[model samples]
Target: MTAYRDSGAPPAADTAGTRRPTVVVITDLIVLAKHLRLLDAAERRGVTPLFVFGPETPADELARHRRDPRHPLSRLADEGLRHVADTSLETLLRAVAPWLRERPVRAVLNVGEVFVEAAGVLAQTLGLPGPGAHAARVCRNKPLQRLAAPALAPRWTLLDPARTTAAGIRDAFSAFPAVLKPASRMSSSGVRAVAGPDDIPPLLPDYGLEELLLLEERIAGREFSVETLVRDGAVLWAGITAKDTNESGTSFFTETGHTSPAPDLTPAQEKLLLDANTEFLRAVRFGTGMSHAEFRLTAEDRVVLMEAAARPPGDAITRLWRLATGMDLDAALLDLALGTEPPTAPPRRRARQVYLDHPRGHLTDVTAEDVPVHWVAEQGRWPDLPPLAENAPARGHAVLVSRHRGDLLGELADSQGRSVSVVLDAPLGTGIDAAAHDATGRVTIHTAAPSPAATTEEPVG
Candidate 1:
């Protein structure tokens, strides 16, 4: 990764003096692909875009994009990329103010969780329509969500990891099973459940949670995320996604896959979820843009809001939405930021996405064969899969589509059950979950024995 220093000098003025509207994008390195989509969308709408990237951006990834002909970054304008050496709020504002003054900024946008606050601050500073810094802070901090919307949120308590000992947490959470997570983080990073005091300390070092944390009573039931587009403080479009995760022995909540248009939810159930989300968003004062809110449905059919972010959903959820509903959420988000109406067409198809995970070891070979259903995309090496933990990365992805809901669900179950049948020859014992989707429509993992050809050889770097 190349390090960037703060260039105190101001950006060169647009010599052509054309007053082309521009969108200021504040984001981090990990979400470059999403950034590329934003850039392409802006250009398609005849708007200029200036990307202010955090210093942590990977130089190698940028170089790869510049080399790939099909990548949008390959055609990025000369002044498209700028670096902010310091990501602090004050420093970011200082660096971005001058740039916005030079161009006619339509809106400030961000997809990554880390930069949402910056985008909100920029919009508020310039008096543009946005979620605002207060809303962004409420969305980013998990405990704040509970405090802001207590009636809709799960029971939670804030903890100072630097001061609170494990014994204190145990006493406070003795009545019920609880979840411990960082106050502000994404991708399930530093998120785990705690049965008692004994399980707390061991997991702290792994997450580096020596700061602020949120310990909430774990809501038991089906998990789902409601994706919404807000305009004038009202929800214009709402899409529900059913989530599947490794439910065997893993303490972490890493998603194994997701299906869109959640076939299992009845119209009434879906309405309840959406209504709760809308109320929560209102309580948080989310005035504009897109939101991805997670919730749990108890056996009594009650909805409990977990958390919500002031941005579009990641992990190809937008792609699934596009495939199912003919709604290009990426484009919609850009349009929303630019103060335009987005598409609100009903869904036409069902879509699903499954991620590949294996044991913790280097891989020698991998293959996908006899896949009964056609896949949208799949590519990755077995040796490169991240370990099963918080923020575990997906090794490969397979997207499936169907015209009917029942057929799509059946296809998803079959594909998930047989997904592990793919040959993954690795030295360590592979954790293959043969029955990933159960009859209840929940995503669970059932580990099976390793194949006979498996060897104990060391992995290659």
Candidate 2:
């Protein structure tokens, strides 16, 4: 094993020549589970994993992990983890240049949204293979993505919130039922649908003056996310995921469930989605790493692009893919970042993730039952449920797997009303509709009923 020093000094001479190729990971926060997977993958491939913490990272947190003998970070050589005062490209270059000179860096990667741009810039600056900073910038800016592939997206315009007036916006998009949202936000934050000029002003205060907003005609169709691995700008593998959202709520868009290997999609729809994704990747100049591209299939069979990111999809989609298919998406992404070929495999099973949401009020307890399929995992908070909006935080989540597609969906439907619910009259599965015509179709949970308890309760098996 190669031992690194924290004093900014190069590792001692590799007398035995046993040091493995090193890959640098830039992250804003330390997710222990994710890092453990990365470390194990690197070890299996005979590579060294070096973690670089950003300036904003809590030093005490890292110190605590470092001091614990059983923690993964403690297993690394003394110099395995390093912290810098600034995350700027120049600062990073100055900080890591000496270390790189000592040990050749195989790749530079980032999984956090905030550090995506930095990862690209550093990889390019260091003469490593990556999508480059331009692609990263396009991935972060949704409006720019639409512009890059206008033919694949709905009619849209980017507006400066400070200068754009409600009247001007209405005039520009006189069409009712247009969608307005921040140009560069995640988790559907600040997204809204407006019927006219009167509906625009009230939503403006929710956004910041400096934030760029995108106003566009909403496309009606089934929304799906295409997860692909690109090598040298060509897609090696593509998986489509069918999405379910809270459509009945007028306030915000909240995801309800997602089924992978979207069994319902026709062959033509799948082809269109994959083809459009390839074009979108090319337009964005994404060269390598995993790309998560979202799109909608209209009733008229039109394929409209929503946005693409040069990273793995969140919400445990990677785990879902691994269950449905024999592919380890996280490992594949790591391989791509390290300039190695990723393995490809076909789907062998079906997997679905359902997010349980309760009505707004004190959450007394959460429980799951009558799940007819193989249960994979469940996680969330309970008992102390905070006030929740239509897009409230998930009360809990469950992952189920099966060999048959029908069994998965059947189990989902069967577990609906009985599996998860709040004390209010609104049941978990009530009014939850999946539509082939619109991506925003959702199950609306009415929270008009009062809460019976003030304390939270652990999830019942």
Candidate 3:
């Protein structure tokens, strides 16, 4: 492993007109493809985006991205894509030294979950704004977040599946209607709600024995997530996102939909949720960066944190925020990273994204009956959305369908199981909930039941 050779000299300052300002972006190809808005924002700011890919990134995938003219990576500055031998802190720092050796970096930002800690370290080492190293580490692990901010977390306990069985844990702790979650997994994978002691045994065998899990008392209440942007230990902007999930009558807690600037929240309730989130950020010692923190507002008015991530909110929540508040979160994130003042605006409208469900079978076709729709059979392809209106609502819905013909439709076990999503924006005081429902209702998913012969006929000699 090579160590970074720091020259003990300050980073070169950008003289107003003489030097060009550049920001380093750390991400893999998959995330890069999904977030084209980042490139748009960088262009708007006249800031160059320098790219860095981890050593594990497949060369073929990188080449494919470069070949695509529309991909963000294709438009990088000359010699912009810096290569790192490995993601180790030492190697990463050494790899980017040549770029920062002359021009001072405005920011070192990470777009997805995979490289939070690395970006944090990079920002700190270069004297730029970022979530501190400690905060980044804490955000990646669920149990760590619980321990970091005990006051905000629900009653939770940890267990090592390799060392014990479901019955063993059930005997030790009998908290009914509790949630079982993997310590470090994302997207609701391996996350289940145990109704009672008996439910534990059935669910425990599905997880790898080597996994560490958390059992927590499920707080009964409305689900919501707080999207926060912070710099210098202070909140620059915060927005609440209302969440809908499949946990109502199901064992799995997959998120079904989300709405930004969560409508119908009273002043006191909004204050409570935002205040709790701020306290959690303070407790974690979050220095800078965007945080997507989820919470449950119980009937008794307690804001219990579900978890938090040190990155932009996923599942199109950022897009909804942009539509609702007329704020380009991607642009704002860049501004925050560069130490420039990020603009802010109160929510003038409500924007929502809802995922549609279908029966389990072989997929035949999915179509929109009347309303215009965007179908995505291929991965990493985004719809060309209309521009955000300055005053009125965007006045339309953007729908995305993920599956293609011949794809298998499975049970709704997690967030990944759902394939269709709808996004709509409306003027303030309008009940977007119904609009979302109506938009989804207009789409039809046609499926053919699986053939028994396919399942029964196995390879035989």
RMSD (Å) of each candidate, 1 decimal: 10.2, 10.2, 5.9
* Poorest lDDT segment (10 consecutive residues) of candidate 2: 376-385
**Model 1 per-residue lDDT tens digits across residues 156-177:** 7777765677778766766457
| Whole-model lDDT values for every prediction | 0.63, 0.63, 0.77
Query: Which candidate tops TM-score?
Result: 3
**Model 2 C-alpha lDDT per residue in residues 225-293, reported as the tens digit of each score:** 999988888889999988877655544555555666776778988999999999999888888888888
What TM-score does candidate 1 get on C-alpha atoms?
Answer: 0.77
Clashing pairs in 3: none
Local distance difference test, candidate 2: 0.63
Q: Candidate order by TM-score, highest to lowest? A: 3, 1, 2
Candidate with more favorable, higher lDDT: 2 or 3: 3
